[model samples]
Target: MNLGARHPGTEAAWATGEYIRHELERAGCRVWTQEFSYRGVRLRNVVGVLGEGKGPISLLGAHYDTRRLADRDVSYPTRPVPGANDGDSGVAVLLELARALDQERLANEVWLAFFDAEDQGGIDGWPWSVGASYMAANLPA
Candidate 1:
């Protein structure tokens, strides 16, 4: 997933979310897509749930979207970075954790959340962490 792009808020985000959902479901967990809004744009948070007990949910999150573009580098500021490390690295790690957790047993409910629009606001604009802010606002208090 290319998290850094002109429109990381586009189909790339959706595709990544879908892929995560597929993997989670394949691992035998129930998955749900949490939809939210960001600067008038619709965003998604893909959630995978494991275990049955309900109390305080343990939530793990990673942003799957990239910046609007690489405005950091002077040579190719307009280009998109692969975001293998920025985008998928944490998600990959969490996926592995989910797999392991599914294989064994857990005492609490685990929610793996892949948030969208996190990379939307880069250095100059609305600022990064959009997805996280949205999630925080929507999460149970």
Candidate 2:
């Protein structure tokens, strides 16, 4: 999946979410996405569940949205960040762990949360952690 910039509210970011959903499904997760919108821009938080234990939940999370603007880049502050490490790397680690962790030996339910709209802070008055906040507020009991 060649998700170019993965800025929130962009095609690349939506494509990246779909890619994550596919990866999670391949990793044996029951996957779904929490849909929401920020300032008229649609976003989603991809969630994957492993193990059916009714005990405490062990949640692993990572934000998948890169910054909309590379403010720290002196030469190209208006451009979006590549986020190979900032956003993509965490998703990579989570996918690997989702595939590697043995569900049969689990003590509690595990949740893999791929959050969106997180990295876009200060650009066009956007806020950080928007997807995470939405998920946390509406997580199923």
**Best-matching candidate per lDDT:** 2
All candidates' TM-scores? 0.82, 0.95
Candidate 2 TM-score to native = 0.95
Stretches of candidate 1 above 4 Å error?
1-6
The lDDT of each candidate is: 0.74, 0.89
On a 0 to 1 TM-score scale, where does candidate 1 land against the true structure? 0.82
Pairs in clash, predicted candidate 1: 3-66, 4-66, 5-68
Writing each residue's lDDT as its tens digit, candidate 2 over 1-141 gives: 677788788898899999999999998989988989989888999998888674789899999988878998999998878999999899999999889988888888899999999888888788788998999899876
Q: For candidate 2, what is the lDDT?
A: 0.89
Best by TM-score: 2
Give the lowest summed-lDDT range of ten residues in model 1: 1-10
Residue 96 Cα positional deviation in candidate 1, in Å, after optimal superposition: 1.5
